[model samples]
Target: MSKRSDQITLVAGGAGFIGSHLCRALLDRGETVLCLDNLQTARPSNLRLLERDERFEFIEADIVNPLPLDVLERTWSIGRVYNLACAASPPQYQANPEHTMLTNVVGTDHLLRLAERADARFLLTSTSEVYGDPEAHPQHEDYRGWVNCTGPRACYDEGKRAAEAMAFDFARMERTDVRVARIFNTYGPQMHPDDGRVVSNLICQALSGNDITIYGDGTQTRSFCYVSDMVEGLIALMESEQVQAEPINLGNPNEISVNELLTHILALTGSDADVVHRSLPVDDPRRRRPDISRAQRLLGWQPRVSLEEGLAATCAWFAGEIDGGRVPRPTAPDRVRASVA
Candidate 1:
């Protein structure tokens, strides 16, 4: 429920990596926020700061079931929604591919329907994976993508693609106001220690001086966006009146190969670890980068944080957590154990 004048905004996965940041951003804007999450993959502590705000409320609910009609009735004044509930990373999504697909397809379907019922503007947090491996070097918005429908990763890639399609249908047919962002690789503090994302994995391994693993000759490249920059981009899109604009790429264009990233991580953490090669996962993209011309022209948005600065902040966070007995110790070089002990 809003406090009379405060506009309400709903964040479906408000406890997860990107969602928590968005929730805080809304709170900063003095908007009342209702966060609905099952906490299946999200840590409650991520949003611990919001517990005291009267304007912020957390609901332990899944989006797969019927929308929380009761909450909606009480807070029916919600003006916007940021649908970010789906499992994001490979480890989490691939663990239960069927549910992951449903979370995207069915979950988006349900949210769009709710947006229709509430007359609220909707924003879907889609992924750059929707573009698949990409024959284009820097993927633009119009690329149809090179996704294999039968591959394991398709559950997430195609699921999001389908989710975007559904959102488009709602906006075109129902004339609902909608915005979508094809988010690329984003990393920052609060990422799960075992999330298995490239940035997190590299940082965690480097912190403990573990053998940094690189797949497929460490040649696959990725563009990394800091979480704060990504949140800013999402906010810009939300504030825009771009009806049915559902596929804009939101990512940093500075590309780095896996090996180069690991080297930087080692330098950042001062970790003496050997880089090791492993087979690339099935359907892993050989390269990816976002062409942000649309974002620049439309929203005047671009990522400002340098990789070194972002990684340093993230490394400091992980190091503090490790020293304070918050995050678990990793199987790394013998050096870090001595530091922690």
Candidate 2:
């Protein structure tokens, strides 16, 4: 994934959880990085480590609008463009559905055109939500999906679908070299504690001794991929010579249920929290697991971290995040202590 020392890689949404990690990975490879974000759903602390590197530059701008004048005026040559700019979490994206749709459709167009202008390779971080409430278990890239275009999650799901179309259109028209990654549930350190995702919700609740919330009778299943593993897959797909204008599935295929996930977190956190059940959110996918065969065949990639190991690491990280602001819980487990150390 290394480019020339002087080549710049631009990551939209670089101040967010996943994007920040990608930015650091690029910088570590000796590439100059421009991290662009509007700070809407981004965490300010995500950029702290990146600011110390002179090779990293942060741009404050939203992709839904036209590219900033200063950005267009800049003379630096961009070799790669990664669009991870949209709000990913349901609560965040659903809060402003209109903006979410625009961020995916319009924002994606802005970045693709930029890639077209610079003759840079482009990558879009599309989501598994595109396969809304999918009937297909172990979903593959070719699945047309069963998404509800008018459902609550439609803003993100359909928007991403449209973004993929536009990205491939540019490629088909011979305007941009495009890579589309249909990412599945990803979790790890630096995830916003209140992002409303199952991993964050269950882990934070267990760590804080709050009631564990299980939705949809606790039978709905989802595969969780660790952030590092997902980042590796993303870079591999981006650098692979064989993939272009083709969507590659990127996620861990180890499926676990909502109740099962809470059980693991409770064990790791030593939480005695009671379980609570709630109705599933509208259009929530009952089963989600990527088939990832394309990723393995095309890029020689598969998840390296086991679910138990990744959960232990996430619990340990959240212990520091939640308890650091409150009194230390005496029930904290030793597994979390050892995992972080």
Candidate 3:
């Protein structure tokens, strides 16, 4: 977990929604960063935030192929490898299921090997989706998920499960330092406009004055963590000497129904868009929430942002995307609601 000042921390998928924020946070902490991304589902605009930093370097490559280890070793010592690669959204991952699966399987293996060879700490950004329609509420780390291995969304869900397996096996063999953070629903600025996540979808649709799409009567529940909080929890996991190979849940414990989330978004965006119901996507989790007592006990980390405050910022971000900065940035105080539209 210790690194010299000259050592580099590589973030695969660094230009993505959450990845970009992680990269920026490292840079803000004066750490040198090597951001590797394939640009498949990531956008160039996200990189604009890091391009000017002299300590930052972006390598455009997919992890499914051989990593540019020759370039990496010749230039700098890799102190850390945070594997946030692969498309996260259902629409994006489902669009190229093979690539998604390979990104998690082969891609994670590639990064783990790189970390092992570099003698660096490796962290895998696993997902909460592993608990498919979980039988248990407030899922914990010991729960061996209820995933459908053959479902349409299995490309990401099961693939991440396999990645965690390989990571733990590597740790079990003493290959390298490993940490896994099973992240729940996270949203905020820098999220791709078309990522098709529930938060982004509703906010963008509302800002565009379109009908709000709700799936499954909007009764399914989820716990949303602010992107900033997620980035902090991730950094804590990656840097902690206390965490070894155990998977820690990183998310807000507060849970709400999908309709509840929509209500918050509608209030923030001030959009009167009619709600439309659609069939739920295959294998969509009926309930999702993480019991983060492990995180609290192990890493001393928990989400610090409230739902309304986080959604306000996200609405502002999507508002700019929908209409070219017409909507002003969110400035509501705690416990107050204001419309971004």
Which candidate gets the maximum lDDT versus the true structure?
3
User: What are the candidates' C-alpha RMSDs?
Assistant: 4.6, 5.5, 6.1
lDDT string for model 1 (130-171, tens) is 888899879999998999999989999999999999999887
Reference-based lDDT, each prediction? 0.83, 0.85, 0.86
Worst 10 residues of 2 by lDDT: 332-341
CA shift at 260, candidate 2, in angstroms?
1.1
Q: What is the TM-score of each candidate against the true structure?
A: 0.93, 0.93, 0.93
TM value for model 2: 0.93
Q: What is the lDDT of candidate 3?
A: 0.86
Please write out the lDDT profile of model 3 over residues 146-183, one tens digit for every residue: 98898899999999999999999999999989999999
Question: Residue 333 in model 1: shift from native, Å?
Answer: 16
- For the record, the alpha-carbon RMSD of candidate 1 to the native fold, in angstroms, is 4.6
Q: What is the alpha-carbon lDDT for the whole of candidate 2?
A: 0.85
Q: Output the lDDT of residue 291, model 1.
A: 98
